[model samples]
Target: MALTLYQEASCGLIAGAAEAYFSFPFVSACLPRVDPTTLSVVLRAKYRNIFDALYSMSANKKISALWTNAGPYVKTRMGTNVGMLTSYNPSLCYLRDSCGLSETRAQLGASAVSAFFGAACSVPVKNVLAQGKSGSSLDCALKILKSRGPLAFFSGFSRQFALVGPPIMILWFAYENVRKL
Candidate 1:
């Protein structure tokens, strides 16, 4: 039962949505929380104190959670879709043609490579999400680079790679196997 291009695209969309839905809460939880009171006071006399009012709103926590996680969620979802679309066929072809690997082996290799690239690309977005600022991702990346050095962008790469890689590989392997069946 080979999947058509449309079916593959639909699967990618489903996977992206599921990944965003499931991972967002964990991502939100990891974000640094701003102390509402402290933030309010600091912004009280600055620029008409809009920050204070915004941070002090009754729905502050929910709003902050959404704000902090939304960008990363979108980034991650898009990255997932792109990674799957870009890597799947290429990896399969490369592994099969260049390496003379079996279909299963090619799939596993492709999945592993895709997971690695996905995790690598997500480092900056993860950092920005962890900081939970309303600023742009570019600004956050620049701030980390300036304050913590160029390598700061990949600060938690090892840990995140360890956490994310195996599951992705497993999921891809399982999906390919199931599809074969």
Candidate 2:
């Protein structure tokens, strides 16, 4: 539930978890495993449905006004502050023990995986709410909300720039400043 693109990018991608699970002695010794673009169509279809459904709910009227400033849907979830340090423990542990992927690669892989997961999980919802829109994308998410104002938050679009952008940018910029310090 707690995967951050920033943290992943800041570190790296590691496949230790998959490796550990995949490396069961019986399977390792039993047969050969080959990587394939083999996700089930049924699974993929479910994700598409979920995306469309959840995306809309983010904009639903009941979202806590407290989160009215939770940032964009993606931002609110992955925004740097929301992630904090605590959430990285599992991944860090996984990286250290289960997977040997470099911190940077592990993070990057995590981000990529998250994106894929998002596509899979939310695709269904997206299709339902925003399907048929020409090339639905992050930009489209913003565009739709730009004209929407307050209600936009419910759409889970929060336009998040206000709540999340400044703090995140500040941290990134601070890191840059620290390099000189």
Q: Pick the candidate with the highest TM-score.
A: 1
lDDT of 1 by residue, 123-159 (tens): 6567766664667667777778788888877778777
Q: Model 2: which ten-residue window has the lowest total lDDT? A: 69-78
Give the Cα error of residue 37 in candidate 1, in Å: 7.5
* Full-model lDDT for every candidate: 0.67, 0.38
Question: Whose lDDT is greatest here?
Answer: 1
- Candidate 1 lDDT (Cα, 0 to 1): 0.67
> lDDT tens digits, residues 18-100, model 2?
32333333222222333336633321223245445334434546634223322222232332322322233454457546788
In order, what is each prediction's RMSD in angstroms? 9.4, 19.6
The C-alpha stretches of model 1 lying farther than 4 A from their native spots are 1-71, 132-134
Clashes of 2: 34
Per-residue lDDT of 71 in model 2: 23
